[model samples]
Target: MNDIGGSDTIKPAAEAGRVTLPEQGLWKNLGQADGLESAAQAWTPLMFGQLDCAEAVCVFLVDPEGGRLRATSHWPRTRMPAGALIGAAEAAMENNRGVVRGGVGDGGQLTGGLVSVATPLVVDGIVLGAVGAEILPQDQTDLRVEMRRLQWGAAWMRDVLRRDASMADKRRYSNAIEALNSVVNVAEQKDIATATRSATTALATRFDCDRVTIGFQRFFRTRVSAISHSAQFNKQMNLVRLLGAAMDEAIDQRGVVIWPETQSDDPRATHRHQKLAQAQAVGHIMTTPLYSRGHFIGAVTFERPTDQPFSQDEIEILEAVSTVLAPVLDEKRRNDRWLLSKLGESLGGHFIRLAGPGYLGRKALLVCVAALTAFFWFTMGEDRIAADAVVEGAVQRTIAASADGFIAESFARAGDVVSKDAVLVRLDDRELTLERLRLLTELQRGQIEYDRALAARDRAETQVRRSQIDQIEAQINLIDKQIERTELVSPYEGIITSGDLSQSIGAAVARGEALLTVTPIDAYRVTLRVDERRIADVVEGQTGTLVVTSLPDTSFPFAVRKITPVAEYADGATSFRVEAELTDGFDNILPGMEGVGKIDVTEARLIAIWTRPMVDWMRLWAWRWLSLD
Candidate 1:
C-alpha cells in the first residue's frame, strides 16, 4: 500500500466496505426530470468541485443548457495526458455503462490504468455528457459506498449549475443598464476621457479580462487609451492601429461597438487603429460613453482573450467610479485655469505700478525743488555790494641830472631817505675842478692886477688897467658856473622811488636826465576808486581805513584828503579816484603799496542792503549800454 500523504495513487478500496453489483447495473435518465432542461448549459464551479478526486476522477455535466456537454472536469493521480479525458468521454458514451479498461500503450510503456469505469450523464431523456474513471491499485475502494456518495453530490450540483446558468442572462442585461448609467453620469458631470479611463480600468480588473480600453472621438479622429489588462498581456507593448475608424464612428453616433474578433478588420486602417483578434488575440469588446457638459469626450471599452465576459456587478462598480472621476477631472481643469488667471493678473499689476501716477508725481516734484534751489543760491548770492574805498598819494618835486658826463661817484641809491641837499648822483667833475683851480689862479692874478692897478693911480693908466681886470674876473666866474652844473644831486628829502644808476662809473648821462627819484617816505596816503554810482555818497573829508593784502587783517586809518575828479578805467570798471592822506600818527607809512581803503558812506538802514546791489547793477548796465570804454 502507498503512504497516505505521499502516495501518487488513490487509497485502497479494501480500506472501506465494498459491495459487488451484478454484471449489468440499471441506468437513470436525468434529462427526463422537470427543471433539468435549463440546468444543463454552461461551466459551473460546483461541477468542477465534484470532479476533484483521487486516482483520476472524471465529471461530465450538461453545461446548464441540456444541449451538449459544455465542460468536463478531471483530476488524475499521475499526470493525465492532454485531451485524454475529453476523448475518453466521447468514446464511452457509445455504450453508456461502466466499461472496464485494458492497459493502453503503443508499444512498450503502459499508458492505461488497472481499472476504468464509464458513466453517461443524461438530462430530459437526452444524452448530455459521459465520464471515464481510471484507477490504479492504490485507488481501489468500496465502490458501492463511494458511488452512492457521488450520486448524491451530483444531485446537489445540478441545482448549483441551474442557478449559475441563469446568472449570465441577468448579468448581461444589468451590465448594459450599468454602462448606460455611467454614460449619463459622465454627461451630467461634464468630464471627458479621464472619467472614461478610470471607469474602464476598474471594471476590467474586477472581471479579470485581458485588457480594457477607452476609445473616444477626437474631432474627425478616434483616440484609444488602455486602462487595465490581465497580467498575461505585455505591459509595454503597443496596440495595432486599425480600430480608429470603427471606434470613431461608434463614438460619434453615441452607440456601443463590439469586436468579437479583431482579425476580421482591414489590415491598413489609418490613424490610431488596432487589429482586434489576430496578433494580440483580443477576443471580445464592450464600450460605453464618456461625456463632458452633455457633449461626448470619449468612450470606455473592455476586452478579453478567452471566454470570460464582464459581469453585472463589475459594470455597476465602473458606473460609480465614472461618477466620482468626472468631478475630479473638472476640478483639475478649474485649478489650471485659476493658476493661469492669477499669473496674468500678477504681471499686469507690476506693469501698472511701474507706469502709475505716483511715480511720475514724485519725480516732477523733485526736479522743481532742485531747479529753485540752484537759481536761488549761485546767481543771487554772487550779486553783492562792498564798502566805499579811498586811496591818496602826495605829489613831489622831480630832480634830474644837469649835464652829460660819466658818473664818477654817487652819494645815494634807492630807498635812502634824504635831506634837501643830499647828493644823489655825481658825474665826472675832474675837468671842472681843474678848470676851477685855473679860474681861481686867474681870479687871484686878476685880483692882484686889480689891486696893483688901483694902487698905482696913474690917472690915464688906471682906466685901461681896470678894464683888463674886469675881463679876467668874468672868465673866472664862467668856470665856477660850469663846475656846479656837472654835479648830479637830489633836490629834496624823500625816499628813492625812481632812478638809481650809481654804477655808471664811466658812462655818460644826458643833460636833464633823472638819475634818481626821491619821495618823502614818512608822508604817505591811501587812494581808492569810488564807483560812479556811489561817488555821490562820498565826501571830501570822510575818514577811511586801509588794508593791505600783505598784512590782510591790519587797518591803517587816514582822513579823506581829496577826491580826484579824474575817472580811472581799470579793466573796464569805471570808478572815481578818491585819495585820503594818512594821519600824522603813521611815521612808517609808505607810498605805492597796494591797499583797499574803506570810506564810510555813512550808516544806512536795512533798505540800503537791498538797494545797493540794484543801484550798482543799474550803473553797470547803463555804462555797458553807453559803451563806456
Candidate 2:
C-alpha cells in the first residue's frame, strides 16, 4: 500500500474541508434522511472520505427515549468496527471530550498498528453523540489535523442533536406542567385518602406505569397510603407490604432508587428493591423520595413492564412531580385529621427532631433544661430563707464619764483591741486639784481656831470650829474622789467599737457622757435583716450560715437566738431584726461586719424554695385587692 501521507493524499485545508461536487451530493444525501439513524449512515461515509488512510469508521448517537448510546452506523458494511474503536467512542461521550488511542507492538513492530480517534458531539453544554475513526499510524501533526476535521464534521450532527434536545425538553416541560395541574386538582380534595388515591392514579396514567403506590413515613415506618387503580385494598396484603418496603428503601437512602440500575449510577443498597422486583416478576421499578419543606416525608414507587425501563428524562420528571406534590398532599392529610390528632402530629414531629441525632448543641441544651426541671420537681433541698446579715458583738458595754472634766487622753479607739483596765480616755483634772487644795487650807485654819478657843476656855466656840473643820474635810474628800474618777478605762478585754476620743484630747466633757463603747473579743452575733414577707418563717433556734464580705471565704455557723417581734421599715422595705449567735467561734470576726445569711427553715422542693417569695407577694396582693365577700 502507498504511504497514505504522501503527495497522493487528499489534504482538505479548511477545518470543515472544501466541499467538492461529490461532497455536496453526499451532504444532500445526508439531509434527505428521515431520522438521526439514517442521517448517520449517510454522513459516516462522507466523513470517512474527508480523511486519509481510514481503516474503519463509526457514528454513535444517544437514544433519547432510553438515554443510552448505540452505534447508528459504521463502515465496512459486512461487519462492525473494531472493539478498540467502539471503546474510544464510548469514552469520548462519557468524558464529553476527544479521546485518542495508539496501538504499538514489541520490538517496535507495527502489529495491527492503527490509531483511533473519537470526538464527542456536544451542543449547548450537552453530549449528544460521538464520531470515531481508525486509521494507519501517522505523525502527531497529521493526527491533530485529522482530529480537527472530525470535530468540524460533527457540526451538522450537533445541530441535529440540539433540535432533538429542544423538542424533548419542551415535551418534558409540558408533561411537568400537566402533572402540576393534576396535583393542584388533587390538593382540592378535602380528604387525605382521596387526594392520595388521585395522585397515585394520575401518576400511573401520566407515566404509563402499570401501578403506582404512595407511602408516608409514620412512626419511623413507611405505610402505604394509596395504590393506583384500587379504590380500596387490604393493608395486610403481601403486595402492599412489598410496596411499602420498596418505598422505605428509597426513603432510607434519601435518593431515587431504580431496579435494573444503569452502570453509570452510583452504588446503593438495593436489596429490598431487588427482592420486590423479583417477587412481583416486574421488569422495572423506580422509587423516589418525597420532601416537604426540605424534609424527607415519604416516597413514591412506580412499577412498569420489563420492556420499558424508566429513562433519565422520566426519572427527572417524576422527581419534580413528587417535589410539588409532597407539601400539597401533606397539607391535605393534616386538614383531614381530628383536632386532637393534628396537635399530636405537630408535637410528634417536634419531639422526633428533639430525640433524633444531629443538632448536638440544641439537643444538649434541651437535655440540660429537662434535667434541671426534673431535678427541681422531684428532688428536695433545704428550704432556706435568704436575708442581709450584719456581725455584732454578743455583749456590748458603753463607758460613761463619771465626773465633769475634759477628754485628756485616749489609749484606744474604735476597732482597737484593749485588755481589761486599759486606759481608754482621760479628762482635765486641774480645777479639781485647785478645789482640793483650797478645802485642805480651810480645814487647817478651822483646826487652828478650835485650838485657840480651847485655850481660852470657850466650849461653844470650840464646838463651832470643830463643825467647820469637819465640813471642810468632807469637801476635800469629795474633790479628791472627783479627780480620781476622771480617767476612763475598759472594764474587760475587748475592742473599742465606737469612741474615738484620740481626736478630742483636752476637750471638756460632762459627767456621765459616753466616752467610749467596748465589745468583748472572740464573741460575735449575726443580726439578720429578714424581710417582713419571710419573717413568718423565722423562729428562734433555727440554724443558718453567714458569709461576711470581708471574710467571704469563711462561713460562720449560727443559730437564731431572738426574732424581734416588731418590724422596722427602711429603704422602701420592712425587715425584722433576727439575732443569731455564732455556734462556731471565729477569731477573725469583728463587730459591724456585714454579709448575707441563709436560714434553714424546713426541707422543701427547690422550685418552692425559689418561688416562695414571689408566690407570697402575689398572695398578699390578691388578698388586699380581692378580699370582697
- For each candidate, the alpha-carbon lDDT, in order, equals 0.54, 0.82
Identify the leading candidate in terms of lDDT.
Answer: 2
Task: Highest TM-score: give the candidate number.
Answer: 2
Q: Estimate, for each residue in 98-183, the C-alpha lDDT of model 2 and write its tens digit.
A: 88876645554444468788999888787888999887745656677888888888887777667667777997887689767868
Model 2 Cα displacement at 92 (Å)?
A: 99
- Return the number of clashes found in candidate 2: 2
Please state the error at residue 337 of candidate 1 in Å. 90
Off by over 4 Å in 2: 1-377, 450-467
Model 2 / residue 355 / CA error / Å: 35
Runs in model 1 lying further than 4 Å from the true structure? 1-397, 437-475, 481-494, 584-588, 605-629
